[model samples]
Target: MAPIELKELKDQLQELLERGFIRLSVSPWGAQVLFVKKKDGSMRLCIDYRELNKITIRNCYPLPRIDDLFDQLQGAMHFFKIDLRSGYNQLRVKEQDISKTAFRTRYGHYEFLVMPFGLTNAPAEKLYAKFSMCEFWLSSVAFLGHIVSAEGITMDPAKVEAITKWPRMTSVTEVRSFLGLAGYYRRFVKVSHVWPYP
Candidate 1:
């Protein structure tokens, strides 16, 4: 880590500890921690839980599908987006399972007393809770990479711009990847039964 990132990491660790989200642990299980750069040039701490997730039993609670969410938004006059801060940290981890969330840092080994991101069950756990702070939109609101409004759902402009500016494909793999991304908005586009190649 860079000197700045290291300092940020230490600060974040202290903050998390003070907030009662994590505590020092002596668990045999430990994951690695790293910092990712946020869009606004801040470091966001993340833990690599791939090893833990591999052995863990997954909770297959089905989350609301995007199409289903959009269907419910139809004819709405206003919209509000709730952006949760430390959303996962708001949920407590079971006493016995706390050690499973342990991660080691140069500072020390710590385990989350609350849930953390990157866990296989985090999404399912989210369904049980709600958070504070909201942004209200009278006309439209950007949600899950799409815009919802009284006019109905449309692809978010930023995402559409990104798709338009996507790099030229150089291989079959790249072409498939691009198609996979673009295909998400296929519902908004017109399609023809006749094949252009055939």
Candidate 2:
């Protein structure tokens, strides 16, 4: 990891520790944490649970589609998007399953007391809990990259412009990363802005 990212991780972990989001643990299963840069220029820590997810049973519950979610807001004059900071931290992992979510960092081994990002079923499990009583409401506040408002959804010009400045993708990973951001806001801008979607 870059020095800056390592610093960010340390800071994040410190806050999590203070809030009891995680606890030191020794477990048979452990995943390494991965970090990504957010558009806000912040680091988001994720556990690479790919291997674990492969063996875990998938949740049958499906999250409502974002487009469908948006449709529900039509003709509505009000919209309130609550930004939940460390929102997942508010969710408690079942005691028995907490061990399964254990992760190791250079600093120490820890397991989440709350939901951690990257679990395949996490979105499904927390969808209703996070959004309940909150439709026209949202879980994470940022939908498809645009911040929702009572005035309705609108894209930030800086973000729309940044998409134009990204270099051409050279790999599948790069393509996924680009699409994950651009695809969510495709209707906000021209499809051509993020061409060659796979």
Candidate 3:
């Protein structure tokens, strides 16, 4: 689908503001827009930019090296993970690329007021900076024990073992491999007396 014009996008933003679905905030990076619900109880305008991200250039930022990560974990045996809430939304995209990042949805097309995922340079320019800054701060501030970067909270072995014991769970590797070979050669291999099918 084609992108919406700037005029139309602004109109949509205005309507959302009028309806009290969003509030505007100013930041050093740029305009930071946030979603707010109306008193009557309705959702605010939110943009989804998955498609635009496909065409944008990805920022080239080097992640922590494996050796560095391992070194940090040397004395740690247990780990817990936490995900930042709306991490990308905290960033602001460059002014020049804002139009290119406009998105369409059922209600209307709208541009992001803050940085979003799937945009080119979003990872390196915004995400990396925020994450690296946090990492730096954590490293500089000493803690009782090491806290490794993880995507989710750590669970005890008993909880994990209970999940493995779920009913109907079965191994299918042998069955899948056998069926794969049979299907692959079905045209050449036939059931016959000479074939001695098993």
| Model 1 TM-score (2 dp) | 0.83
Q: What is the TM-score of each predicted model, taking all chains together?
A: 0.83, 0.66, 0.38
Which candidate should be chosen as best, given TM-score against the real structure?
A: 1
Backbone steric clashes in candidate 2, count: 0
User: Candidate 3 on 138-158: residue-level lDDT in tens?
Assistant: 322222221233332223344
Residue-level lDDT for 120 in candidate 2: 70
What is the per-residue lDDT of model 2 for residues 82-125, given as tens digits with 9 covering 90 to 100?
44545566678899999999999888899998898888777523
**Model 1: per-residue Cα lDDT at residue 38:** 88
Instruction: Give the clash count for model 3.
Output: 1
Better of 1 and 3 by TM-score: 1
Q: Which candidate model has the greater TM-score, 1 or 2?
A: 1
Model 2 lDDT at residue 101: 91
Q: Candidate 1 has which clashing residue pairs, if any?
A: none
Judged by whole-model lDDT over C-alpha atoms, candidate 3 comes out at 0.45
lDDT string, candidate 1, 1-198, tens digits: 888878998999999999999999999989999998887898889999999999989877777998898888888998877667667877889999999999999899999999898998775335332344566665788787898888888899998998899997788888777777777788877882433220
